[model samples]
Target: MKLLEIVEQLFAQYGYLVLLIGLPLDAIALPIPPGNTTLTYTGYLAYKGVLHWLPAVLSAYAGAIIGMTVTYWIGYKFGQPLFDRYGERLLLKPVHMERTKQAYQKHGNKLLLFSFLMPGVRQFIGYATGIIRVPFRTFALYAYTGAAIWVFLFTGIGFLFGEQWKHVLIWVEQSLLYITIGLGAALAILVYVKWRKYVLQKKATARAIDR
Candidate 1:
């Protein structure tokens, strides 16, 4: 059977257990199933009254949190040695790691809030955070919140779309490319606006001092 077919059967038979186990595995970057699709399908099932909404959401949220937490600790404990051995192969030079660390420090923990929205990024951010030695409390706060939002957003889409959730998932996948572009543009605009304001303020201060 196809993977999706197997996933559907698992959900049909196991419901909560499948979500709890599957979501964590996905968060840990395992290749078993598509986490987002599973969550969305669960939401559709909930809409059809085959599962409870609260439990489904909670299971997904908890699973993701747990998986990420484990991955983070693994990076914390073993990242240095692994990186030292395989860093060149992965193109992860010390300079690159240092630059990433600097960026994280400058951005602060709040930057993690959007990590969940970025594919391939969410899986690594936890590991990166751990490697950088971010406090567990801060990690949990930002990461968990982001996970909750991500899980709810996809699941809610499934529930809302009912039988049409598959189309929505396809649209989401396609739109993400555009979304990334739009976000980049928006960030650039924001930076430009902020820089302009800073320049204007500096000029105003100079005028005041001359006066």
Candidate 2:
């Protein structure tokens, strides 16, 4: 009847569902607490002998990759028009996109490999990688690597902490809140820097081309 009852039943019977449901929602930026809670709970379930660690890890990685793929497709196919109409109001600067593209271009696979760990950048880096039309095989390779590590890190933390994980969850949430704010500020600074560099480079190139 109530949602809590449903959750209790699910937790009792199928702990993996938490990973399946939570990962995608988090990836979509729904303000759901990060995937760590689902992960840690899964870890606890595994410790209680009701779940398996490998499948839990796989479920997490699969859910995140699939959710991120959807986000990437949405951004690739329709994000540009959406941006054209509302970019200015939302602070979605095109130059930030450009700079991210350039970063991917110069660093190639390295950026994708580490993108998962980077706060505030992780969620968009995958989507932007696809929107910019990075090769699928390459995207899959690096993105999966990142997702695997991401899942393992949280799952391992939960497993190691065992029953004493509530403290970890609280600390993680508070840290993430600070991280979100810091990331917003950092992104703004990055957009400004990227835009200025782009403008200067464009002017120089135009002058050279004219001569």
Candidate 3:
């Protein structure tokens, strides 16, 4: 069955508990009903008055935070050993990990800040932060903020768009790619400027000492 269909039935049967339970699993990569769709549906339910808006939003956000936190710790404590020992079985080869590391070196924090909004990425980004040993303060700053935005954005879509939520999802997917590219280019330019200044400072320091 399609995920939405399955989700529909679950929501019909379980109501608020679905959000409370499903979102956390989705963060951990299980994605039983998928996070974005679920949130949108949550908004729709609130709009219909089937679920109260305040509790619905609260429950969804709490579930997402719990899932992300657990995923982060799992990566911190056990991710490396599991990858090292059983990477091939999981199809996460050593080369893949190395490339991810290099990419993260360049745009890790930027990606981390918005990772929760994207499906495949949201699942792994928490693990990446943990394995990379990002500071707890930094993780909370970016990850939790992203979660809040993600919850509000999608759920608000459902609330506002009503029956048209699916169409907006399509628009969101298309637009996000372009937005990411534009932001990435801007960040790259900023990084280049900072690097150039640092190099110039080092060169000037060396010349002065030699003189």
Best-fitting candidate, measured by TM-score? 1
**lDDT tens per residue, model 2, 1-211:** 6443444476677567766776777677752545656666667667767788888788888887876777667767776677677888988788966866777777767767756555565677766776676777888888778778877777776787888766886676577668767766886899799899999999999999999
* Candidate 2 C-alpha error for residue 102, in Å: 1.9
What's the best-to-worst order under lDDT?
3, 1, 2
As a TM-score, model 2 comes out at 0.67
Instruction: Give lDDT tens digits, candidate 1, residues 139-192.
Output: 899999989988998899889999999999879866865776787789799879
TM-score for each candidate, following the candidate numbering: 0.78, 0.67, 0.75
The TM-score measured for candidate 1 stands at: 0.78
Worst 10 contiguous positions by lDDT, candidate 3? 173-182
Error of 1 at 32 (Å): 2.3
Between candidates 2 and 3, the one scoring higher on lDDT is 3
Model 2 misplacement above 4 A: 1-10, 31-33, 81-100, 107-112, 118-120, 172-211
